[model samples]
Target: MSDMPATPLLDTVDTPADLRTLKPAELRQLADELRQETISAVGSTGGHLGSGLGVVELTVAIHYVFNTPDDKLVWDVGHQCYPHKILTGRRSRIRTLRQGGGLSGFTKRSESEYDPFGAAHSSTSISAALGFAIANKLSDKPGKGIAVIGDGSMSAGMAYEAMNNAEAAGNRLVVILNDNDMSIAPPVGGLSAYLARMVSSSEYLGLREFAKKTIRKLSKRAHNAAAKAEEYARGMATGGTLFEELGFYYVGPIDGHNLEHLIPVLENVRDSEHGPILVHVVTKKGKGYAPAEAAADKYHGVQKFDVITGAQDKAPPGPPSYQNVFGETLAKLAETDARIVAITAAMPSGTGVDKFAQKHPERAFDVGIAEQHAVTFAAGLAAQGMRPFCAIYSTFLQRAYDQVVHDVAIQNLPVRFAIDRAGLVGADGATHAGSFDVTYLATLPNFVVMAAADEAELAHMTYTAAEHDSGPIAVRYPRGNGTGVPLPAVPQKLEIGKGRVVREGKTVAILSLGTRLGEALKAADALEAKGLSTTVADLRFAKPLDEALIRRLLTTHEVAVSVEEGAIGGLGAHVLTLASDEGLIDAGLKLRTMRLPDTFQDQDSPQKQYDEAGLNAEHIVDTVLKALRWNEASATGGGARA
Candidate 1:
């Protein structure tokens, strides 16, 4: 609390309505205070710091210019929304971000009315904002849909698709392209700022409209030539020919950090009569903060750090991260196998593909934010006799599911899918949680689904997937570091459908999948202490369903419980379906399945999330005990079966 920054101007404004009351000259101080408040808040909470720092002036300019709650403003990928959140009545709980039962790192529709649409995914803001614009246009309402998208997000085809259809929205759609990474034009200066303000001004637009009518009164070819010459002149000056071609009246390459330049341009765009408008505002990733400006990526997503010094809190050194383990293993394996290659959809370092790229830059490819293309590209490589591993986060992979099915599974291509973040992700909440990959991928035909219980198992599964040319094989792992198990020096190629029993017992059988194997073993220990002999089996493959191993465990044990860190339709559903098909459940078999609850979990610590979902050791013990009691009651005929 003592380290919190002084924000006198920010304290006077709670919402955009309050922000709109300030004079144009006072807004610069308000933006400065807002930036300080954002840095201080994120310093304690440790979330996206650099992106929010970059957008402080822009956030102030937008809220000061527009009626925000009424005029829907959608942020692409929502990482830079902390400053916006502070400006829009969430500063009190700003320090509670990414914690249990607190504010989310990304925007949520349920959180506030100011956030018109919730977004954590990339390239969806334009589409969502267009929907709002068209709906308002249809209802004859006085609201505009403003989409703030990044240049990196523009790499996806969806943004262009939305732009192509944006002509119908008329003047109600305003797209602010936040160009922080790629400098789309020459640096913003006095001339460029003046051009942006002049072009967006109503006087210039009115004169242009009159000229268009006058030219149309002559010949159609003359009108067309006049428009082309005018558009090309502006295109050469401001560098927005591409956006002009997409049916938007392109404006700017203005300074995003300069409130003097940004406010007037935004105010002009709001008052203009254009159907769809695109404003290109260039900014640095970390504009005001010196530490973040120096190293943008390191501070982009940060940990709790000192306010005076930007030194993030580091976790105690232990085993390597699961991603790094996979990357190193793949790189090592690729040395012997020339066909091995790697692909990632913009997240090279996040997915560990950067490690592979470092070893073999020619083979490793970062295809930007195009997951659909990544999957299909890997499929093509596989068809051409190259072992292409499409490494992507499980949440992002949902975008390319059609490609996974049509391009890979239907063709039976051997494209190896290295699914990262394959379980409940902490802090990022349900939006980034990889909760459905097992359920989704395991159900598909010609797909081999494997969940690694530890980093050692991940290495084996990685090698296994590399060697398997039979069909499309996938290996999924969690977000954090491995469970400290010693990685194999020489990785083994595991059998496709065989599961290994980690702990042996007779009375209770706990079938485990993914990283929840540790909890399953702990549950076995607790069950054994309670006079129950428990068996824990790490069922690696979720698809093929280790029928023989599962059948033996189900028949031999008094109670069989399936434990997996996935949704209802994953390992438990498969095992249940197999039991029903083989008539294993008809013989009074007491079967129980432990999985994540049927709800989207909020941001929390991983341990608390698992406990809240009732998938922890104590929950597993309770489930086994409850089932055993029901079995005993059914056998005695004293109580009815539960």
Candidate 2:
């Protein structure tokens, strides 16, 4: 271990104050070292590697310039905060990132004092920093508040809302716009155009300053005329008239990676005592690492990899990821249907739309981090007689709930939503978990909601959603690899408002939904050993609950349990709705609904979380036995089997 290379200068930093102690020259070295550490850490653990590597210098400069913990720094999305975490007393624990009981992948107020406002979602930092600024003003505090947001995040309406409010309020807030020219993938929309304008306006800045000085020397009337002329010229040149109109003191198109340039620029901004300012810093997404720089988006989020070659370890030779399955299925479907188009909110690769985009470039749409736009845009496509498959993560789909209700559902449009990450996402924690989509989407009128038991079912649901032309339909699937079931060669529509019994038994029935059916199967096997036979039923769709099959189970079985990988108001709640309406209590049937408890699950392994939530095989078996009053009889020496 002593023969090992010295720990990076970043590893030496335990807080911002420690970073402040470093010489400006040392910070350059620190940045290089931090970049290496971040690359290595992410290679080992698998996470948002590219974004963090990109921000090493910026992270160092901010910590060195600002009085953190006292002076709040909010990072939008926080995916790029790995270097921030390393600097802020988490260097050692960086190896355990996204693991059970490890440091979070994003900023967490509870995790560190340096992280003033927690964030995982985009377009929230400005709002959060403005809140801190307002609080500071109210409390008579003297520290500055900064929000580091990406150009990608700025595309969202919320970022504009915060910028609008911050500018209007005339608050002491500094918005560091980290313009990396990407958001997981290449960015989209008018904001991208605005950033392009800023990048190309370097010469215009000098001209504007010259014009300003020249205008001051002119007569009063000439000056007024020149001013209007200058405003028009500046607007045409810089394309920042929009931001200026928003009342922010827009600064820079600065080089974010250059320590010499960034340090002084940040120092100037820190001391200027201006109203809300937007400092646009243009940096490469994966600046230091050669592999990441070459394939920035691919390295944006990576699995464990070889640090030397930056080659990710081969996944254990087994089943394919659900994403791959979705991609293959979508590609197969799109080959036949010219009207079938795919849309994603800056997650083409993650959501498996990359294949669709590659195969059918004309039909595939990547709408950037604008989930709301993606939804309405799909609605537009649907209205135009095109079948739009709006694929988005369940958590992100929450951003466009109103659009789902109004633009799609209310209009009875045939916009199919391929909701990915539809359960507890293991490492990214509560913020990224797809816990509420089922409950939320199920409640919407004219919306059909379904969950896949496995990859085959997912393919079938995709087909069903595509063929169903009546209204909006959503099919949700989980994060990891699918069960090793052979996918169908051709897509087929399943009967709506239906479910299937996977295993037939008597005495107890387990009604499982989503990918949790596998665990339910395992539980069924364990219960079989205990002589308590279980009937395992997969309720495919959540919205149109198979009441007939459910009622049949309740009538025949001694006890019934509803299981789903979601929160309270999901499948369990829907079952309870049926139970209440049919007066199952009056019928003297024992019913237990097993779903995720109403609490934010902490950072842990997905399997660990499942076990903790009593959704694992052993726990499911235990729950069944307990519900059957087997434990009570065993305790009373009634000769119950162990």
Scored by CA lDDT, what does every candidate get?
Answer: 0.92, 0.84
| Alpha-carbon TM-score of each model against the true structure | 0.98, 0.91
Report the number of the highest-TM-score candidate.
1
lDDT for each residue of candidate 2 in 1-642, tens digit (9 for 90 to 100): 222235666666888888888888898889888888788788778999988887889998998987887878999999999999988889879888999989999998899988889899999998999998888887888777799999888779898888888853344688888988842223333444354344334344556567778888989899878876755564554345667677776655666787776776676666654467677777898898899999987888898988889898777888878887887788888888998999999899889999888889998888889999999999999999999999999999999999999999889999999999989998889999999998999998888999999999999999998898988999999998999998888868999989999999888899999998998998888877767778999999898999999999999998898999998899988998898898996888888989887888877888888877778888787777777668534533221534
List, residue by residue over 1-642, the lDDT tens digit for candidate 1. 778888888889999999988888898899888888888888898899988898899999999888888899999999999999998899899999999989989988999998889999999999999999999999999999999999999999899999999999989999999999988885558999999999999999999999988999988888899999999999988888988888999989999999889989999999998769999999998788899999999998999988688889999999899999999999999999999999999999999999999999999999999999999999999999999999999999999999999999999999999999988999999999999999999989999999999999999999999999989999999999999999999999999999999999998999999999998999999887766889999999998889999999999998999999888899999999999998989998999999989999999999999989998999999898899774443443222235
Candidate 1 stretches with Cα past 4 Å from truth are: 630-642
Report how far off residue 9 is in candidate 2 (Å): 4.4
Window of ten residues with lowest summed lDDT in model 2: 183-192
Report RMSD (Å) for each prediction in the order shown. 2.3, 4.7
Which ranges in model 2 have alpha carbons more than 4 Å from their true place?
1-5, 8-12, 169-171, 182-239, 631-642
Evaluate residue 572 in candidate 1 and report its C-alpha lDDT on the 0 to 100 scale.
Answer: 97
Task: Report the alpha-carbon TM-score of model 2 versus the true structure.
Answer: 0.91
